[model samples]
Target: MLEKEYDVIIIGAGVAGCVAALKLVANGKRVLLVEKLKKIGSHNSRKLDVTESQGIADITAELNLPFNGKFNRSIWYSPNANFELDSRVYDYYVLRGSDVDSFESIVSNRIKSFGGTVLTNAEITNYNFENEYVKSVVINYNNRHQVVNCKYLFFADGHHSKSLEIFGIKERPGPTFIGYGEICVNSELKAGVTHVFFDSKLAPGGYFYLGKADNGEVLSSIVINKALQGNISIKTYYQNFIAANANILKLLGKYKVKNSFVGMGKTGIISRRSLRNMALLGDAGRTMDPIFGYGVRQAIISGYMAAVSAIDCLNNKKRDLDEYEDKLNKSVFQGRETENQKFRNFIDHLNNEELDYAFKSIETIGLSTSLDDFFDNPFNNIGMLLNVTLKKPKLLTTVIIKFFLA
Candidate 1:
């Protein structure tokens, strides 16, 4: 069904967009959520994100929705199992995909149940603005363009948002990220844990992770830079990488892939979060934090914040939504960008041989550490540096020297 007007129009229905809509409608506002995809959730990336923050757990608990699992352990697996660090991780995991029990579906269904209208396979072809406020938006649906009136627009449509160029808005450019993932049934992986592999041959431009294998299903995903990977295709490389790993083979036993998905996006935050009454959240803004391997929690937090701010503005005659960016800066996004920079630098400075040595040093110390330190602060940890220096002096002489030189 189509409506003549809505109090707010939300673009995209991922975790961020859906949360925004849920909050708006729950606050007694009319919201129209439009998605170009035929459905709300990711195709088949179940247990796709293992977050390292408790911030997002609030939203699930608030909605009375249970998360998939709580991860208390993570292993930073080095090349060839030469060295690995099994450490403590304080975070929860969420299930993705179009399944009824998935986070995306649950949040989306809640919106509709609360009187929000969701139109899948819909695209915003054109829009009109009155002064600085949005007047109406044109959505292309069912092979026809339809117009609907709305006072505000919120776009959580990823880094390359559809609404950006239309308003002459400049976006913060970032790396082009491509990912491939799949889920298989009857796998032999233990739940409540995760593994991150950082080998160049295994995942050239990026890396791969295997975890959250539970209830007869396990998720496996790999990321790579095609140009960096050279002649081999990502699929071929991924297939071979998975099969060649003895640990993965042992875990697989006998299994069949049920569903596969391809994920593509641009990294970094949006340069302009709000233009007039339009605002961007999620990947459109800067919800993707690299250190944790995923940022669904951050995405959900950003969406909820955007929703609350918009509600206050729409209900109380406020019009300074540009301050949304400022709010984000003080909240979830605070200081993390710098950490992300350090993490990237650390990754860039390491290869297979150096990585093995670093993990070997960590293993020697018997430090039950959360990877957050390495990804969030790199080698800046004083105690860790001291221990590594005394335990693996050669690692400090070689890898540390190279890290500084780069």
Candidate 2:
């Protein structure tokens, strides 16, 4: 058995944990980052194929850091509209499965360069908390037991976070959905644009996306109503999906499935209060707008914000966790709440009549934008709709009174 102490201890080594460790160590605080997986980012079900750079643009701007790399903008589909999305707006750079090894290497190298310690395959068994504050954590790594004491603990352990449960934190329910995806090489599809197919028959309560990787592989996923109910396996879903979409089937002619991934179970809007001595980031804190399925970007941002708060608390000699909570609420949760309500309203009201009206309105409006554009700037999209209504008052009244009215 071994014992150690640090200024901060972070659990989980996904992108969130890595970003937290980077922030803390860069601020000159000693950090011990532990991951239960054999390697950092191994458990991440989301492949590092596209939108890596565009995912972090906002944070890069805020921090005045250079994160520019090659990422391609793609289209996103909504039942109401098709949008052309620019990756820069989100700070994520798209890469292929072949690029994942290099990307992980770069992240690992960055951590070491910033003077941080990373221990993999270390599973946390229990935590010692006193007076609502975490004092230490017991971990078993490589057949050895150890205890790590720290002033602050950040849980980036993700949705099924055992740490948050142990700490007696309850997750608030919101919009939830489930789905799966895969990577297929030698695909006949072009390697760039993202194609989203929305049909209740295929995915039920969710949507499907087919993103082309840089290496001529297709990265696809389907979002469904909760994880367990989506009994359909990835293989079955993909085969059926290809059969249903004529365009997709034509593009995927004579393609072989190289690598496949499945993510089942409910993923939805969940928010938890960031507590004292302990803070949750990534999926452990809250999920992104499930409708958009941008959880990875949200995780990275939350992790960075959590680290900043932790550093402030440690440096200011304040035990109050309110500051961290305030930052989180003001930044991530507030926007999420609004979006959640709006999407819920939209989904609930979507029927054949509403869809017809929306499609006609979009066509008459003659808006020269894709679904990705609408999703990237929802407020602007709403404004556009309002402008259209102002010009065609009857259309606006019919949409609101017929669809929105109870």
Candidate 3:
């Protein structure tokens, strides 16, 4: 029914696509950002009521693109134990059931401020490529089919992205999980701290988080491992979780469930390359390190990097997209691979004895040990484990040394 052409066509108007459009537009390129949904940020974007603190604030600040918003500090809790981290590490926690329109409005305003056009309710049916380069895309919007040509295409369409499949990209298998969350208003809980309850019974290999949003609403979520192969409903899981964790239920006693969100996907380590003319960003690029499950920051960073690489290729008139590979290697690939391997190993060998010893080590050495120092550098963790094993031989010997030591 309609046809148009632009310098770039971005599929999926979530954070990654929006960020890419913003960067591309800032670079003086005309972009056609399309979304299959009726509105932007309706999928995983809507599911997020709170943004977790990532190392991005510093990185973005360095790039002179600091997010213009207020952040509230919060806590993180381990699901399997009573361990509670009282650190102010997170940047902000969104309240449950916050206004999706308001969030989209902010993002839309930012995109417009950067001179980008957003197209919602536009579902891309397929892509047209020639000589290993993207040429155009066939789309359906409002009961009509159309084709839009573009010089470049960027896919940020979440985990099971349809765009990637059209471009001949496949995702590697990895661990997965099913998760659900809700936002409650007018609760008795404090307005700043996030509470996590680690209950294996309710979440299995996953955990739950309860936090106060910037607007003083409560957001709670339950993440469960899909590897367990159970047919338990999210509603049932929430009920069981509430029954076990009285403190959370008590705080949320009178608050109505304003919004319920559910997501089912692979949450573990999945590997895929993004080097073609049509680049893949965000969850489509890699899915790993669900420990924090902060795909937003990853999406933003990857989108920025992809745009930069694409710009370089265009300016240099180089058909080879090797720089994108290098950027991903440095920023995502290697780090993600290592993190995923480490997590898999850790989870495989984790048991009561090992956990007890690890906790004891934490108690003795304190939490000052940097995450990098312990995980990245194998020798540091080995030394700590050796110390614990020597003192508590009974507890340490039962654990797998190779798993944690590496």
Candidate 4:
């Protein structure tokens, strides 16, 4: 059994776990960071580089943390027209496809420098609950069993967290399949532009992307909203996507597949991100965006928020940990859950004809609207919608009905 009782015990060493440990230790609390994987951020490896939304910059500035991630502008291609987004826009930043390891390593080193203990190859097998709070955890480290007790626990074990079953926390449904791979092509692709296709035939109820990596490789991905586990494979989807997209074929006359990976994303808004003495962080608590599986920023924000909540409870004797969930939902989702759900709902019920018409309208009339303007008023755009309505009234009517239904 471990002799030292930490003030807080954080499971998992991803962005969220590391951030939590860093914050807790900085606030004079003894923290132990534990991970089941041999190394942190190993699950993040893929042919595609990492891309974060504008939230990462906001988080670093707000928390005063030292974070410098390289960013390049990217383009989002709708069905009909391509929307160019400036680098300064608060939408997203495309990280070089090759910086995944270095970025994670930097954060891990930062946590260690703060005097926090990190245990790799550690597994939390069970939990002992005292009354309504987690009292201690049984961990297996280096082929030895040990009991680690703590006043507060932060579970960042990711989407397949074992802590949820131990705590009896139910998970809600979300996105299921995301396939990533790298391909080398002998053609000149757009430097920073990320081509996104919403064709259902390519990626049913989801999207596909083709972007350039720093190493002069093309990183292509097919992200879908269904489960691809049993018999379906990512290669099958990639083949279908290539067959469906002419632009991809024209852009890259011949390509070689280098690597491939499959990932799952489920959108579950846990009503409780925390219990009495413990809280779930990152994908462990289902903090991913419902519309898109963009979660690195969410994971970071949740980790920081969980740390803040733990510190507050530790400093104030009268404070309760219930505020963690409330603060987390507000800070992370920010009332975007409902809006995102509406978008998902529309997509769920949209027929292929309606979707094709919508994309066509965007290609025809969407050229007038900028990316920022469209996001600001995606549905209620009078000028753009009116022009599309004049061309095809049925398309606009179906959109309105779907909006209300969603």
Identify the leading candidate in terms of TM-score: 1
The residue-by-residue lDDT of candidate 2 on 128-187, one tens digit each, is 988878889888888977778889888888777875566566555655555566766777
User: Model 4 misses residue 328 by how many Å?
Assistant: 1.6
| Model 4 CA lDDT for position 255 | 70
In candidate 3, stretches whose alpha carbon ends up further than 4 angstroms from where it belongs are 1-3, 44-46, 49-55, 58-81, 84-89, 94-104, 250-254, 267-272, 335-342, 348-357, 367-385, 389-391, 401-406
The C-alpha lDDT values of all candidates are 0.72, 0.63, 0.63, 0.69
Q: lDDT per residue, candidate 3, 1-406, as tens digits?
A: 2337877788877666766777777788777788887766666434444454454565455434433234444333333334334444455432211244344445555676776777778888877878878788888878888888887788878777765556555554556767787867787777655665555466666667776665655667787667653787877887788887677787666787667788765543334445467777777766335554533566667777777877887787765556766776676555666566566545534554455455556544445455434544657677765764578766655555646674
The positional error of residue 137 in candidate 1, measured at the CA in angstroms, is: 0.8
Q: Which candidate order results from sorting by TM-score in descending order?
A: 1, 4, 3, 2
Q: Which pairs of residues collide in candidate 4? A: 49-97, 80-363, 81-363, 174-267
| Candidate 4: tens digits of C-alpha lDDT, residues 1-406 | 3545888899888768877887787788888888887876666654444446555676666444433233346655444445445544433322222244344555667677877788778888877777877778888998888888888988898788876776677765655546655555554676555566676555666777766655566767777767523456666877777786687777665677665655666677555778788888988888887776653678878898888888888888633578778887777787777677667767766666676676666555546766456667767687766766667776678777888988
Q: What is candidate 3's TM-score against the reference?
A: 0.83
Worst ten-residue run, lDDT, model 2? 90-99
Root-mean-square deviation of each candidate, in angstroms? 3.1, 4.5, 3.8, 3.6
Q: Could you tell me every candidate's TM-score relative to the true structure?
A: 0.87, 0.79, 0.83, 0.85
- At residue 272, what lDDT does model 4 achieve? 71
Deviation (Å) of 304 in candidate 3: 1.3
* Model 2 spans > 4 angstroms off: 1-3, 49-55, 58-73, 76-105, 227-231, 252-254, 264-271, 335-342, 348-360, 366-406
